[model samples]
Target: MAEIKILGAGPVKRGVTQIAAQFEQGTGHRVNVEFTGAPTVRERVLAGEAVDVAVVPQSAMEEFVAQGRVSADTRVTLGRSRMGLALRKGAAAPDLTTVAAFKQAVAAADAVVVNVASSGNYVVKLLEKQGFSADKAVKQPDTVKVMDHVASSAQNLLGAGQLPEIRELVDKGVAIALAGPLPDELQSITAYDAAVTTASANAAAAAEFAAYLELPAARAAMAATGID
Candidate 1:
């Protein structure tokens, strides 16, 4: 019935794509979702990019609302996920049962690659707390690049990314396997929140979709992507 454009974070590729299709089918709304890095999502919105809705890290919602980039009241949590460990194909999975084992695995790794996003942020803290050298972690701009570096490298490497993104990468043959979710206490969770943009031309439709994100059906669709 209406058309809306959504700017979504890279980690949200799976969840957003899945839900958008269902929303379009159920509502007869033409939904177009563009996936990019989290930083780009913020940059585009802050720079006045025309969009109906956007899904980004919940941590950015306050900033967007404060900047008048998106309607504060339209914000809703779509999905959530925590960091996941990845290792080169056939590499031994780390023993995440204890912090000591995790640290030892890190020390033994020929190289450690991490995306400079939510996943990496949590990993840096975990490494610091365990007294592991953060310098050992090679930071990539995003998860795609992190997986590329790990998969292509001949060295035995360890990488980190969002749980869903890591699994996505594994399917692409980028990372050999997912190593872990880390200790529950040490894992960092990121909430994927969606909001209608202030610049939307189709405010009503955008708001409708934003609200639909909280519906049980939509929430389940998002979770099916392993992001929730």
Candidate 2:
């Protein structure tokens, strides 16, 4: 049996974690997963961490391939994730169908919460381009903490994160309202990709697991976790 160590971003956590268990059971391979922000994952890999496989944003994976940290031939596209907004439960959901309405909602919000990751950075830039200052936006370390802050805070808070991360919390009936995905024009869709690491000791096994993630069952698992 081979043991595979996987490093990935927050958006693919739930889906990958769930599928990893299934992969282990089916192939007798032990899967160890480490999930963090997208930027952190890239930093760790680039810093020469001994990861067997990595699931990261497509852009980051491409850079890794170029840097000879990961095998480009082994890269497999995971699904895409869009930014989404969440509010405290029982609060009135805002109209975010249009970018103008989204701007209004942000302007009227008491406070905005975003993580210090890919989705949050994108939202901040988008807000700035729309003439809104994100300086006051509460930044958390991860998406889960962002939801936790919004859930516990008495203040009316608007939380922004990747759809998969926020949707997982919403599915669990967290004390947050699903305000839906960001408008198309304002949305930043990040494509996720997985590839075997060049430093992998179990390169063959890692390649096998990467291929497994592209199977129909794996795609279904990702879809169930809101990764599509």
Best candidate, lDDT: 2
CA lDDT, every prediction? Answer: 0.83, 0.89
**Model 1 alpha-carbon drift over 4 Å, by segment:** none
lDDT of 1 by residue, 1-228 (tens): 788999988576887788889888898999998987888888899887889998888888778988999998999987778777888787778887676777788888876788776667777777777777768778889888888888889888888888888888777766468888877767788888899999999999999989988889877877777876
In candidate 2, position 88 carries an lDDT of 91
How would you encode candidate 2's per-residue C-alpha lDDT over 181-209 as one tens digit per residue?
89988889898999999989999999999
How many residue pairs clash in all the candidates, one count each? Answer: 1, 0
